[model samples]
Target: MSSQFELLTTRRFLPFFLTQALGAFNDNIFKNSLMLLMAFTAASNLPMSTDILMNLAAGLFILPFFLFSASAGELADNMEKSRIIRWVKLAEILLMSFAAIAFYYELYMVLLGLLFLMGTQSAFFGPVKYAILPSLVNEEELIGANALVEMGTFVAILLGTIGAGLLMGLEQTLFAVSCVLVGTSIAGYLSARKVPAVPMENEAKPYKWQPVRQTKQAMRICFEQRPIYLSILAISWFWFLGAGYLTQFPNFAKNSLGGDSSVVTVLLCAFTIGVAVGSMLCERLSGHKIELGIVPIGSIGLTVFGIDLYFATPANVGDQILAAGAFFEQAYAWRVLIDLSLIGIFGGFFIVPLYALLQQRAKPQERARVISANNIFNALFMVGSAFSGIVLLGVMELSIPEYFLVLAVFNAVVAVYVYSQMPEFVLRFVIWMLGHSMYRVTHEDLNNIPDEGAALIVCNHVSYVDAMLLAGACRRPIRFVMDEGIFKNPALGWLFKLAKTIPICAKAKNEETFENAFKQIKAELDDGNVVCIFPEGKLTRSGDINPFKKGVERILEETPVPVVPMAIQGLWGSFFSHHGSGIFKSGKRFWSKVKIVASEPVAATSANAEMLQDKVQQLRGEYQ
Candidate 1:
């Protein structure tokens, strides 16, 4: 297990990562510089008030996501992404040049127009930014790749923002900002040139010029897959919450914390650093897989810390404004910073897996379009966040901290709804907890399980948690076949049901369940799904291999799918096993080392109960 940072050393990921990071950095630098100028110095020259101008600026920048995202997605899907990136980066260089002129001449309108164009460029880059990763890295590396990209993105945003503020304080502000903008753009273009060209996955579709129609089409494509659709919505919700918090930070610092501008920067730094740290930690936490289990953990943290932040805010407002150091000395200031940081950390945990899952599961040909739809939704959610802030803080007259409390509650509601709609998230979380907490689990030759297609996995039944441990070990989803009694256990039954486990009973006990279990197994196999069966038909009462049942043969005779022999080692005496005092009655074993070994698939024509038993026994080998 090499670190995700190693990818930065390779040409395949390094160039594109640089290009993406520099692009984000440059965008924020220009955007923030323009904002600071308007707020501090240029407000008097503008017709609208500073507040209106700032709001308008924010809207203008995000508006392009709504207007051009569909077209951008289509173009990304239709052409080689590297070529598009180069051209987009070149356009950025041109746009930034004009922006430099706008800054030099104090052409505020021109600057705003350039801002919109910058947004348009980013909108175009959004789809390819993510869609290109699958082409650059292997599936196993996708989670790491997403983590790096996310870490780079937030870090760039933070540096660029801080840089803009610093540049604004300089005597030659406009000249310095202009130079950095154009220089960063040129560097981004050069990086884009080095990115390895990726060919289109499918032939170009006929171009549609209507943004409205294309937007609907892209959204329809996104909604076509249930899991992907929910993932997009979940991601959009994150952006919504993020927008709300970011929008209020200036006021939150000034009014609530009695802090000056420097304090706002400190808060931003805490949150941004948290997200970067969390993003980097995701690869390790997920064991280099797109583990959805951590998503629930993220949501929980977001809600918990968000609410804590509300409590952390001091009720008293002093007329004296504090600088960063003074603010830190105040009561509860550290608490507020920690809350914001943890919120960002959990946000990273929430976001990375969904992005990887979307990339992994979406149709490759339409992946760009699906991502485009996600951008559109993200934009809408962000816009909605602004409105929600206006309503809550203005019309509803809620304090900033109170408003945060509302957002946290709403987050909980949204999380519950999402998990209800997609129980797989909760199920995976349970399995992930089992793997990370109760056992230090490892896998051997698990890649022998095919990436795609129907296959039958035969493993010796060691305990009630066998299926879950196996689920956490494998990358793909598996439908496990279990005896009805264990599958219907009051304690674990709901989890098994959520996993869509096929419950079976002997024909003598219940003919319908026995017959129906085979039917469901065949149906799952025919649908090109992986199915796992415990051939022993029951947990071994002793720490030894039970004789394989004939049910496996019946399954192979009907389905004829490839059979994968698997073995679970070191679980015999654990709490879930029948060994010792019986299941759940034995002494607890925390962090017990466990290994799951998988062997090459046995052909359907050659597989049988006895052969699979032998192969599994060989794989298990005395580990138990």
Candidate 2:
């Protein structure tokens, strides 16, 4: 719904997108064509089995990520990124020329070698492509920009993969594939030439040449922050998961689904389309912010859908290979497609936030290097995944479906382990689920919340889940100050505790509780954390703004943090609000449209409970 496509018209982003997409397209075309040729045409002449050859091809392509990502990261950090991209694209053109020659001669070894060279080019280009985005786009546009890149990349991959397979089936296979690959490479180079220059970050820093030492240095940069390190690990695991699934698609279609090459194309198109759809949806779902909440949702969907795929797949299709149309005619085949598509959808959710977070949070000087570290780990994981699949399917003699089940189970374990390490991801997921399920929350001017340093958030409490909704809308973590009654509720208390929400009581009822609340607020603000308080003190019984309590003034007086006023609209009649007689006895407006309007920050000197309430009222308008 957002204007993500508009970025394509901009000089800063358009050329880069075209360059990246063209590269992906060429890579997939070459890889898929070679794999298809080996699997069918050259299987008899090749020394190795088709499966082994495919695995070897996959490993060879990824080898550069492990070997050169460190050096590439350094170069990206020290060199002008756009210029580096142009040079990389030129390398791509040369490599594709070699690939064209290999295809013409049908030189198997030469083709494999060219695959490695292509991988090398991509490895060098990866850091520059990702790291340059922060320079080209502002923070708010990062998610949308990444979304477009992701969509374009996968779509290009889809076209390349499908086109290669189709072209290889033609009479003049070598000539057709070569022409397309060479053209794509040249187009990529031209696009790279048009990319607007992005200023270098560490132009004077000496570039590292030693792969081993530089790789270690990149790892150190990644380990500099725990979240960043975890993100890299998570991203690597995604590649592991993706590699396992993608590598098995051809075999799965042939042996498992009892379908021919066309079915494999269906599987590829379905999954790729699903990923593109999911990536495009991220900008809307995240409210144009780098929301990590989608990570958990994606992980869960991936596990669930992955496990379901095993069940959806039958033990065997008939001995005869079914065409694409016939494959879809089978009732169970549709289910398999759905499972794979959902897996891709969830995969989109899992990776996008991590990428955005890495870009936004990593130190600018070392960001590209950190990305290289991520690439190295990703390659390692993917290669390891191939071996693991071989062991499970070959040595252990597990069926392909059984291997899928195993991967799904492993995914669940890994997701739980990661979330256990960082509960913030899960916390945000819970907040996101609450907001999305209960209301359609449209955020306006939510970026008014400061990115860093302490800030006091004053909002009118409209419902029981207002804090969760607010947390979901604003990118920052908020420690909500809730009334003692709600804080002590058994059902909701654990959530508040997990979020570290501050609980306060009426001064006359419990002076100690009230006093401790202010102390905690001061400590949090002093530590440069956001603290949110409902200055209205209690939910409005009349569906109108309640009078402001003096506690907000007292806390602001003590902390002197910038006060941001936010208003929640369209929740008054909901089940969570104090409509009719009590909560849940009133209207149950499931997925009711709501809005969160955040006004500009009021200076601590000018801020008061009454004035903040007035600002919230103005923002809320007649929605309540």
How does each model score on TM-score?
0.98, 0.91
Task: Write one digit per residue (lDDT tens) for candidate 1, span 291-344.
Answer: 999999999999999999999999987899999999988888889999999999
Q: Write the per-residue lDDT of candidate 2 for residues 1-624, one digit (tens) a residue.
A: 257788888998999999999999999999989998998788887777887888789889999999999999998998888889999999988988988998888888789989999999999999988899999898878998998888899999999888877897799999999999999999999989999887767756666489999889999999879989899989989899988888788889998999997898899888888888888888888877899889999999989999999999997678888999999889899899999999988888888888999999898988899899999899889879989988999999998888889999999999998898877788888888887786787888988999999999988888888888888888777889999898888877878777888899899999999999999999999999999999888888888999999888888888898999889989988877877885556366656788899999999999887788789899889889
Q: In candidate 2, which residue ranges exceed 4 Å CA deviation?
A: 36-54, 451-453, 506-516, 526-528, 541-547, 580-582, 586-592, 617-624
Error of 2 at 599 (Å): 3.0
Best candidate per lDDT, number? 1
Deviating ranges (above 4 Å) for candidate 1: 582-591
In model 1, state the lDDT of residue 227. Answer: 96
Q: Find the candidate with the highest TM-score and give its number.
A: 1
- Candidate 1 clashes: the total is 0
Candidate 2 lands at a TM-score of 0.91
Once model 2 is optimally superposed onto the true structure by TM-score, how far is the C-alpha of residue 168 displaced, in angstroms? 2.5
